[model samples]
Target: MKAGLFIPCYVDQFYPQVAIATLQLLEKLGVEVVYPPNQTCCGQPMANSGFQHLTKGCDELFVKNFANLDYIICPSGSCTLHIKEHLHHDRHEATATAIRSNIYELTEFMTDILKVEKLDASFPHKVSMHQSCHGQRGLKISQMSELVAEPFSKPGKLLQMVKGIELVELSRPDECCGFGGSFCVFEEAVSAKMGKDRVADHINHGAEFITSADMSCLMHMEGILKRQKSKVQVKHIAEILNASL
Candidate 1:
């Protein structure tokens, strides 16, 4: 299947490697991937900040660039969730639906669409999983405990299939890492406290590396880890899934 890659602004600026790894994995899996140069922000930063009206230009830009495609894949869950949940055009219900239905986080794309049960990747390290709210909850990409459906899963199972990688459990697995976009700054005390606790849990479990589908959350956790002088490093699931060492 042909898929259009949607890289968020932050990913483009700070985490281009996630996008690169995502593209590489898709190609390795035999899926035709295309990156439209015109593609930029998903209008998420503005929309999530209660400025949905300001996203019109971005919305128009996105529609103009990717409206024709059926599968829109993204490395960052926050960006994909924002676009799927908030991209609006009253006169273009079809366009809105197309955008929402087509978007997929990397893990969902692999386990659901590709039905890829195994990967030829290896990483000899103890890893802790951070379940990002957008990927785990917003998109409903995986089964959440709060839901009534059969237990949803993609991250854990996929990682388990990889050779030499040990999946360590966090003390509070599903708790938010306090990176709710502007929430980090608006509630600095609470956000920092929460992030510190999350990082502490990972360290307590002897995790040398922290991994998640959302880089924003990992970035927040990384900040706290750095300030605390912890040795644990944060990595996106795409990087882990594409791991070689």
Candidate 2:
């Protein structure tokens, strides 16, 4: 099936390698992926900042770029959740609905749609998994620890398929890293503290690196880790999954 790649603005500008890894991973699986030349932000930053009404242009651009695709896959759960829940156009409600239904976060697409049971990738390192809030709660990719249900994770499942990668367990598995887009800017003290705490958890658990599908969260944690002179590095899950050896 044909798929459209929706690389978030921050990812496109700041972390292009994640986008590149995502593209390479999908193509390796023999999927026909299209990168829309006119695509931009999913308007999530503005919407999460309480300016959702001002996202009309972004919404229209999204719909225009992706309406015809069978699936619109993004490496970010935050952006995909925003589009799934808030992408609405008064005059083009049908298109908006279509786009929303077609959007899938990367791991979700890989596990749920592609049914990828194993990978040819390998990473010989001890790593910790950061379950991004959006990927866990918004997408229901795994059971939230507080939910009293059997725990599972699509991203974690994919990670298990990689050779020589030891997935370390965290004390608190799915806590927010405090990089809630604009939440970090408005609540600087709390954001930094939360980031520090998150990094500490991974480091304490013997993680050589922290991996997650959301670069925003990883970026926040990476800044704190660097300041603390920690050896743990941050990587997008796509990078690990797409690794050749």
Candidate 3:
């Protein structure tokens, strides 16, 4: 099946390696992938800042670039969740709806759409999985703590296939990293403190690296890890999945 790659603005700017790994992993899985270079932010920043009106242009532009694709796959849970719930166009409401239904976060697409059972990638490291809020709560990539059901993790499942990789357990599996988009900019102290707490869990658990489906969450924790002069590194799930491929 054909898929369109939707790289979020922060990822496109700061952590482009995650986007490249995502593309490589999907192509390695034998699926045709296309990237819309003209695509920009999905208006998530604007919406999160309470200026969703400014996202109309962004909505229209997204539709123009990704309409008619078999699936729109993004490496970011927050951006994928934004399009799934908020994307709209006054002139092309039907197209907007179709794109929303077709879009999938990277791990969800792998486990649900691709039904990925295995991978050729491997990473020999003590890695901790930081279940980002959007991926956990919004996308349901993992079972929530408050829920009474069988626990599952789509990303964790994929990671299990990687050779020599050890998935470390966290004290709090689904806590927010305090990188609520513009929330970091508004409440810098609270954001940093939350980030430190989140990073501490991984470091204290002997994690050499922290991985997440959402790069924004990783970026926040990366700052904290660096400031504390910690040896732990942050990586997107796609990067580890694409490793050795």
Candidate 4:
């Protein structure tokens, strides 16, 4: 299948390795992937700040670079959610619908489209999973509630398939990590408090490394962990799933 790789601006700079691993993993699965280098920000920074009007040029650039692709897959849930939720064309309704329908987070694409149940990867460590707000709640990629439906999972199940990897459950499994984009800066007090709480829970659970789909969230948590000089570490899910012993 032809896939358009969309690397968010921050991912291209700070977390390029995550994008690299994502591409490698997709290639391993025989995906015909193309990197649209002309592509840049998904306009999420502006849109999330309620200044979506400022991102019209960004949206146009995105549409120009990737509108012709079969499927647009992004490694970051927040970026994928931004495209699915906001990318629109006031003059072209069909174009808006096409972009919305084609966007997919990497995990959702692996589980839903690729139907990959197992992978030839291994990580010899106890790991904890942080469900990013966009991938878990916004995108509804996996079941998060026991009260509503039968227990379903894509993240945990996929991790379990990796040899020498054990999934550790967090105290508040579905709690937000407090890296809600602008929310982090605007509410620094609450954001840091929530992130510290989440990190503590992972440490208490004996997790050597904390992993999540969004590097933004993990980066936030890592800062607090480092400040406190905690032995625990944060990792992106791509780093975990792409691991080899």
Query: Candidate 3: how large is its RMSD?
Result: 0.8
lDDT of 2 by residue, 1-245 (tens): 99999999999999999999999999999999999999998899899989999999999888889988999999999999999999998788998999999899999999999999889999989999999999999999988998878889999999999999999999999999999999999999999999988888899999999999899999999899888888889999999999898
lDDT of each: 0.85, 0.94, 0.94, 0.85
Off by over 4 Å in 3: none
- Tens-digit per-residue lDDT, 114-220, candidate 1: 99987999989999999988888787776677667797568877889778998897667888888899888789999999888888899999999999888899989
Q: Could you tell me which 10 consecutive residues in candidate 4 have the lowest summed lDDT? A: 145-154
TM-score of each: 0.94, 0.98, 0.98, 0.96
| Candidates 1 and 2 compared by lDDT, better number | 2
The TM-score obtained by model 4 is 0.96
How does candidate 4 score on lDDT?
0.85
TM-score of 2: 0.98
lDDT of 1 at 106: 85
How many Å off is the CA of 127 in candidate 1?
0.4
Model 4 misplaced stretches (Cα beyond 4 Å) = none
Residue-wise C-alpha lDDT for candidate 3, range 79-151, written one tens digit per residue = 9999999999999999999999999999999999999998999899999999988888999999998889999
Q: What ranges in model 2 sit over 4 Å off?
A: none
